[model samples]
Target: MKTAMLNKYFNTPHESGLGKTLYQFNGLLVLTFFILTFLVWGGTGYSAGIMLLLSPLALFVKDRPLQITKEHYLIILAFSLMFVAHASAIYRGNSAAEITDLDQPMRFILIIPIFLYLKKVGFNQTWFWLGIYLAGLICGWQSIAYTAGEYGTRVSGPFNPIIWGDIGLVFCLVIGVKIHHLIKNKPQTLIPKYIELSTAAISLIAASIGVILSGSRGAWLTVILLALLFLTIAFVTLPKRISLAFTSVMIICSVLAYAYIPTVNVRINQVINELSSFELTSSNRSSTGLRLQMWYTSIIAFQESPIIGLGKSGLTELEKRLVNEDKINNWVVTESSQQHSDLFDMLAKSGALGVLILIFFYYSTMKAGSALIPPYSSTIVMTTLAYIGFGLTNTIFIGMNGTMFFLVFTVFTIVAGEREVTSK
Candidate 1:
C-alpha cells in the first residue's frame, strides 16, 4: 500500500517526481521549439531551451546505460564532418578567423548532446506532430500577411524568401505524410483523428499557398521533382487507384495554378526569358543568368584548384582576379558572395575532400533512415530529400536559420524513429 502510494506520488514507477517533471517540461520545449521555428524573428533560438534542458542531463546522467546504435554514430559523423571540413579549410588558409566561420559547424557538434538526451528520454509523437501542425498553420498565415502586392512581389519571413519557401514546402509535405499515416492507421470514428486531419489539411493548403506566393523558382523545381518521386512511391506503397487519384489531383492543381496565378505565370515566363537571353559573354545578368554565371565561375575555380580547391575565401579572391583578367564579368564579383549551390560552393571552397565529406554525410543519413520502419523512415528520408533539393540551388549551411532547421529536426526524427523501433 505504501509502495503504491509512493509510485502514484512520484508520477511513474521508473522515475522520480523531479525526473517526471523535467521530462514533461522537455516535451513542452520540443513542441514550442517547432512552433516558433517559422513564426517569429530569431525563433530558431528556442532550440537553446531544449539544449539547456538536455545538455545537463547529457553531462550528469550516469545511472542509465545509453543504447547508442550504429545509426546514432552515423548521425554524429554527418554532423562532425561539417566541422572538420570547415576547420580544415581555415587551417589551410582558405578563410580568416579561426573560430568565426566555424560557429555554424560547431552548432552541429553541439546538437550531439541533445541527440543523446532525447534518445534517453524517449519521444512523444503527439507533441512532435501537433507542433508541426501549428508551425505550418502559423507560417502560412504569417507568409500571407507579409504579402504587400500580388503578381510580382514575394512573401518572405524574417529570412530570405527562398529559405521561407523551401521550409514551407517541406512543412506541406510533412503534413501530407502525417495525414496519410492517420488515414491508414487510425479508426475513422475517432473525433481526435478527424480534428488532426482537418487541421493538417488546412496547414497543407496554407503552406502550399505560401510557397507559391514566395515566388522561389528553386522551390518550384523541388516541388516538381519531389512530386514525381513521391507519386512513384505512392504507387508502389499505396493502392493503385489511390496513387493515380493523388497524381491526378496534383497535376490538375499545377495546371490550374499556372493558368490562374499571375505570380506563377510571370515567374515561369521570367525563367524562360532569362534562359533564352543568358550568355557567358553577354552582360545579360538576370537572376537566373547570375546563378549560371556564378556556377560557371565556380567551375573555373574548381579547375584551378581541383585537389584541395580554394579555402573559404578562395572563391572571393578568385572572382576578383577573374574580373581583373577580364576572364569573367565584374558583375559576378560584385553581386555574389558564395556560389549559390551547396555542392559547387564546397567544391570551389573546400575542394574534392569537402565534396566527399558532404556526400558521405548525406549517404550515411539516408542509409540510417532506410534502416527504420515505414512511416518514420519515410519522414526522415523525405526531410533529407527536401534539404538536398534546396541545397541544389542555395547554400543551406551558410545561414543560421537553414542550418538550425536541418540539424534540430534531423536529430529529432532519427531519435523518434529509433524510439518507435525500440517500442515495438
Candidate 2:
C-alpha cells in the first residue's frame, strides 16, 4: 500500500491553474534568491526558508505527484547520510548544547522537498544563468567598492573574506563556461552575439578581480586551478592557437597580480616563510602554523575515536587536554573552534563515519551531475571542485554562509541542468 501511494504520488504532474501559479512564483523566488545571495546578509538562509515553506503547497493540487528520479534520490540520500552521521556523533558525545549544530545538516535534508518542487515546477535555464551573471557583477562591484575604501589589505562582500572571495572565484568559473557555451552555440534575433559575448567577458573579468582583491590565498589557488582546467578544455575542444593565447593571458595576469598587488606578494611570502619555519612544537602563531597545528591535533582526536569520533564537547575537552599536555599550542585552540579544514573538522567532531559520509555526499553530487549537457556539466563539476579545493585549507562545512551557498547553488544548478537536458 505504501509503495502504491508513493508510485501514485510520483507519477502525476501539476497542470491546474494553481499549479501553474505556484510554478511561476517558485521560478521568481529562485531567480531573486541568486541575485541577492551575495548582495545581502542571510540571503541564502532566507531563501531556504521560503522554499521550504512554499514546497508543501504543491501537495494541495490534486494528483500533483512529485517529479522524482534516481538522481534526486542520490542527492536526498547523500544529505540524509550527512545528518545521520552528525546526529550519531552528537548523541555519542552526549552534548546537548551542541544540538544546535544539527541545523546545518537538517538544511541539507530539507532540500529534498525543494528538489521535488523545482523538478515539478520546471525551471527555465535562462533565468538561472541570468541570475548567476548578475550576481557575479554585483560581487565584482562590491569587491571594487570595498577596495576603494582602503579599509584593509583585503576586500570582501558582506560575508567573511574567505567566503566572499571563494564565491567570486566560482563565479569566474561559471562565467567562463557560459562564455564557452556562447561561442559554441550562436544566438539569433534579440541580442547580438558580440554584445552578449562582451557582457559575459566583462562579468568574468569583474569576478576575477573580486577574487584577487579579496586576498584569499586559497581562493587564489582555486583561480589558478580554474585557469588550468580551462586551458585543458580549450586544448581539447578548440584550436591550438586559441588555447595557447588563453594560457598566455592567464600567465600575464598572474604575473601582474604578483608584482602589483601587495597582498598577493605578502601572502605568498608568508606561506613560504611559515612552511620553512613550521614545527609541530614550535608554538607558531601564523595562519599556516596554526592550521598545521590544528590539523595535527585533529588527527590525534580522530585516532582516539575513529568510529563515531568525539562530538563538539569531546573535541573541546580533548583540545584543552592537548594544550595542557603541550601537544599543541594554547593559541591554536584560542584562534578558532574549527580545524581549518572540512575533512579535519569532521574527523575531529564526527570521526571517520562523518568523513565517509562527507565523501559519499560529494560523490553523489558528481554522480548526479554527470547527466548535464556541455557548459552546464562543466560548470557544475567545476563548482563541486571549488568546494573540495576550498575545503582543503578552510572549513567550508562549518560556516553558515559557506555551507548555505554551496547547498543552494548546488541544488539550483542541478535543477537547471536537468531542465536544460530535457528541453533539448
Residue pairs whose backbone atoms clash in candidate 1: 94-311
Q: For residues 1-424, write the lDDT of model 2, one tens digit per residue.
A: 6676444323223456676576556666777877787678777777767878888775665544445678778878998887777666556656464657677667767877877767655555656766777878888788878763233667745778788888888888899888988898866324577887888898888888788778788798776776787689899999999998998998898888789987788778889999999877677687899899889878988899998778767887888888888888888768546789988888988888888888888888887788776677787788888988888889987778888888888888877776422211
TM-score of each: 0.88, 0.87
* lDDT score for residue 156 of model 2: 43
Clashes found in each candidate (C-alpha, N, C closer than 3 A): 1, 0
| CA lDDT, every model vs. true structure | 0.74, 0.76
Question: What would you estimate as the lDDT of candidate 2?
Answer: 0.76
Query: TM-score of model 1 relative to the true fold?
Result: 0.88
Give stretches of model 1 more than 4 Å off: 1-14, 49-54, 62-64, 149-152, 187-191, 231-249, 281-285, 420-424
Clashing pairs for model 2 are: none
Off by over 4 Å in 2: 1-15, 62-65, 148-151, 188-190, 226-250, 282-284, 420-424
- Please report the candidate that would top TM-score against the real structure: 1
Instruction: Tell how far residue 341 is off in model 2, in angstroms.
Output: 0.7
